[model samples]
Target: MGWLKDDVALITGGGAGLGLALVHRFIDEGASVVVLERDANRADSLKRKFGEKIETVVGDVTSYEDNVKAVETAVERFGRLDTFVANAGVFDFFKPLSEFEGPEISAAFDELLSINVKGGLLGARAALDALIKSKGSMIFTVSNAGFYTGGGGPLYTASKHGLVGVVRQLAHELGPKVRVNGVAPGGMRTSLSGLKATNTADESLETMEGFEELIIGITPLRMSPTPDQYCGPYVLLASRENAAPMTGVVINTDGGLGVRGIMNVCGGEDLSA
Candidate 1:
């Protein structure tokens, strides 16, 4: 049997990208999953692809009611929730702070924070009762941006950092029953839609030159990770037997951003500078 056999998992944004990858991995490991995707089409797609093995919920993570309904649906369908993966998130597409005026920046900050930080927090809260009853775990999808400065612009970085705080705080408060943690992925290609900012995932290679340069130049491994590779850490965290003692842990699946090239003095310059 696989690590998560018979486990019931709730994965937000499971219709695509890292979320989709995690769904496939979890199911292959013999786990049942509920996909909470905002896009109705994506939810339908998951139903088609995974058949009855997966449950699809059309909801937004930012809404408390939606999160509530999602967790409830998971319990109703699977009888219990063994794990909750708060993987629904979007990038701010490096919309530099300088580009936005006072009002624009305020609007942008609110939008990003609402979707990224609030959504994860709501997911955790929604799953609290079920998780405590099952003694389950919560795993969030933080970005390399959560730890470092260059992964994204101001709003995104701030949101991720805030999420790290959420994971740690929840881990501290709900210990011994509900394990809380996060995974900080570096860069991967994915479809992240439904955001006010520019869509980073759908951008072309030529459009991502600056982004690629920023990532590859500093990563010690010098290779961007795939969305699928990042799912392993989540699976490990989700498995009670494997990561029982790990709480408040933030795994860096970010291609070694910790041990990498130097940062420039001129307001933190890039590789070529």
Candidate 2:
């Protein structure tokens, strides 16, 4: 039996990248899923691919109404909500503070934070009632930037840090009823796009040169994980039997970044001898 047998999840940004991977993983684990996606084309693709096993809602994560609609669709279709994954977010393309003009910085901050931080809060609020009734959980998709530097620019890192606060605060407020947590995954070769406010809307991480190699070189594990590889932590967190006492936790699945040595990324490079 799967860990999430018969569970129902509503995932924002379920149309692509890590979110799309989660949709597949959740369903494979015996969970019904409802996707709140901003892209019409991706929403249609999900419907065609999953058919009736999943429900797709065309909406923006930054909008409260859209978040509510997604939660409503999950309940109306699947009967109850077991998990709410706030996975929709945009990047700042590593544009540093010095690279932006005064007005541009403000604009980029607003655009990025509105979607990355505010979007998660909106989704959490929308799913609160159903989650309280089901004793469910909320999972936010955080990034390695939430803890360390260089993962992204100021805007992206600050937004993820803000999400960390959201997870902790909500966990404290909804204890004994709804659990809140986060998963911080490191660099992956996804189509993660950038902010239009900084003129990077057309840029995608996949298009960056040496992206995978950079991730491997900087981490102790020397590997570049796929979106599917990061889905296991989500499954573990969503499983009621597995994560009963887990709340206010942020799992760092970033190739052992926290354990990297100061002189070397990994100390066991020649241990086989």
Candidate 3:
């Protein structure tokens, strides 16, 4: 495709799930990427697979220094940073309000929001200079929860909803120099993990039974898209030629969630049980 030929991007959580898929898709479109993955094993694997086309910066998105390091790696290794994708996030495992104690709610909220929302802010701030210099863009990975309910529990839902605001404010603040946008995708069978504070750090979406069926049933399109299938919007938002006039916009790739009428994701079950 080469739509992003010679462009450079810094993507957080590029170790697995949708982040990993973005890495592959971006490379296929002729863009070199610097991945800010906290897992050393996953970072090493990216290097082995993509070789010099990818630069793996092992770091935590919650840390400003680490975010800066990732941005630096993109510029130092690839010469310029054109896109910064804040895609790292943790789920609440659909844990509802009744499922948490007062203190546990605070802890889970802190842990989940720190990575999902604050991490995106830190990454965007770190890459601010580079993006402006290149007249580039930022793509945030929001979820179906950003615009509607039932995608996740309260904590996860709040974070994604908050991201939609971030995409707008930043695009408003940084425009004429840098573009900012977002992509809100629906449920998928990915390695999306949960909060440690809720004793769900090790729980991944792949281990959740009936998740696929639930998503297909809830979505109007009746399809659960894979990570690769969701990469097109990011590419579009990253493309200077295509998305030149677009900013502060969020592309809804949520399997027709915008048109789907009101529905219950878990039905009338006792959530506390």
Best by lDDT: 2
Give per-residue CA lDDT, model 2, range 192-230, as digits (tens).
999888888889999999999888877877889999999
lDDT tens per residue, model 1, 105-199: 77667777888889988988999999999999999899888898867789889999998999999999999889999999988756654246433
Model 2 clashing residue pairs (backbone): none
lDDT of 3 by residue, 29-85 (tens): 999999999889999999999999999988899999999999998988889999999
Q: Which candidate order results from sorting by TM-score in descending order?
A: 2, 3, 1
Best by TM-score: 2
Task: State model 3's lDDT.
Answer: 0.93
Which residues of candidate 1, in runs, are more than 4 Å off?
Answer: 197-214, 263-273
Worst 10 residues of 1 by lDDT: 264-273
